[model samples]
Target: MLEIKNLSYRVENADIVNSVDLLVPDRSFMVITGPNGGGKTSLAKLVMGISTPTGGSIFWDGQDITALSVTQRARLGISYGFQQPPRFKGMKVRDLLEIAAGEHISHDKACSYLTKVGLCARDYIERDVDSSLSGGEVKRIEIATVLARRCKLMIFDEPEAGIDLWSFARLTETFQEIHDRKEASILIISHQERIIRLADEIVLLAGGKITAKGSVDEVYPQIVSDTVAGCNRLEVKGAC
Candidate 1:
């Protein structure tokens, strides 16, 4: 379980994340949705300890982990997949998976992980994690790494960003598989309707604050209607 108590962060005299409190129970999938620059990514970073909270505390399973470093948090079963995955100049895909798995994973097991993200193991396992791989490919590999880690708490920031339609479908299935098979707690940040509908609970973040949070059936309709109306208004004014 993850408990965020009055968590707040500020930068350049502006509060990027306000005093927000949230609770994410175990074995559940939660989706955070909002427009761009709405603090969704910042909130994920704070949970992953990539950015420290200026106020309040973050408790994971009753332990105060607000001050723990990123590596320390990862050691305690927290994993974060970035919006833009980094390139590894000298690392092979197989090697990275092995490192993430933290054990000797056989070729079959490695293939299983890659296949979940729509990559053929024979083609990708030996490839280096460099610029040679396209953005979509690297993102999928990053997700595979997260699966290999098998963390209890996994946070994925905009997993659908660079993925094509075919790969996006595979990624959705992979997320569902993770929730169904491993019972992992997943916090996904995305604006895609399909992804949002998969959530057991939806958290709506706007202007660095949670405006609404509830089950999919409870919260999604309001968000969708409001967003569509806002878009139409913007189109009328030539702002979009």
Candidate 2:
């Protein structure tokens, strides 16, 4: 299980994440959704060890890992995908997958991961993870690498970003498949309704705090209504 207690992060005396407590049980899927700039990404970074929290403790399976480095966290079967995935100019897609797995994976295994993200194996297997690939393609490829890692905890920061409608559908299916397997705990930061609906539990964060938390049936309606109202208000203000 992943446990966070009184987690807080501050910059220039502003709390980006404030006194957040969360628990992600094994083999479950959770979604964190909130308005833009609501600190969803920041919370994910803290969990991944990319950012240090000014207060509170992070525990994975009862071990205090708040001070562990990013690599140390990954070694503990934790994996994080960025909002904007980085590209390696000279790395082959296949090479990246094998490296993520920490051993040489076979062609079939690599293809399976790619297929999960709606990519054809032969088409992308030899391609460089560089400027040549579109943003969506690179995003999917990065997700494939995360799958290759087969981590105990998988955290994705907006996996649907830059993906096409068709690919987004495929991506959601992939998440469902992963959750169904009961192999790992999945935490996704997404505003997309499709992604949010897949979560076993949903958390609504705004202004660096969780304002709502519950199962999809309880939280989804509130989120949708609030989002629509907020957009309408924004439109009126913008028109004025």
Candidate 3:
């Protein structure tokens, strides 16, 4: 389980993430959503150790990991997929997947992960993760790496961004598969209804605070409702 207490981040003079507290239980799928500046991404970064929290503590499985570095956090089985995954000029897709797996993963295994993300293995397994590939393709590859890791807690920052409908459809199915199998505890930041529907619970964060958190039916209705303040309405999508 991941426990965040009084978590916060400050820059210049503003608090990007206030004294927020959240919990993601083991084997659960949780989605965090709110307006664009709700600090959803900042909270994810804090959890992944990409950015240090200026206050509060981050505990993973009951360990105080507030001061852990990004690499140290990864060693603890916490993986994060960036909103815009960086490209590697010379690294082949196969190499990246192997590195993510931390072993000499076979070509077949690497291809299987790619297929999970809706990409043909043969075409991409040997290709470089560079500018040659489209942004959407790059995003899929990064997602594939996170899946391949099979981390204890996987955090995805807007996995749907830059993805085509066909691929995004496949990606959503992949998330469902992982959830169904209890592959890992999942935390995703997205406002898309499709992704929200996948959440076992939804957390509404606005103004660096959790305005609400509960089951989809419990929290989602209020999110799209007109009366909620700072709702930052969802980018609605079809239901499952």
lDDT, candidate 1, 24-123, per-residue tens: 8998899999877778999999999999899989999999999999999999999999999999999999999999999999999999999988888999
Query: Candidate 3 on 39-149: residue-level lDDT in tens?
Result: 999999999988888899999999999999999999999999999899998999999999999999888999999999999998999999999999999999999999999
Q: How many clashes in each candidate? A: 0, 0, 0
Q: Any runs in candidate 1 off by more than 4 Å, and if so which? A: 228-240
Candidate RMSDs in Å, in order, are: 2.6, 2.6, 4.6
Ranking by lDDT: 2, 3, 1
lDDT of each: 0.91, 0.91, 0.91
Q: Which ten residues in a row have the lowest lDDT in candidate 1?
A: 229-238
Provide the lDDT at 10 for model 1: 94
Question: What lDDT does model 3 reach?
Answer: 0.91
Give per-residue CA lDDT, model 2, range 42-110, as digits (tens): 999999999999999999999999999999999999999999999999999999999999998899999
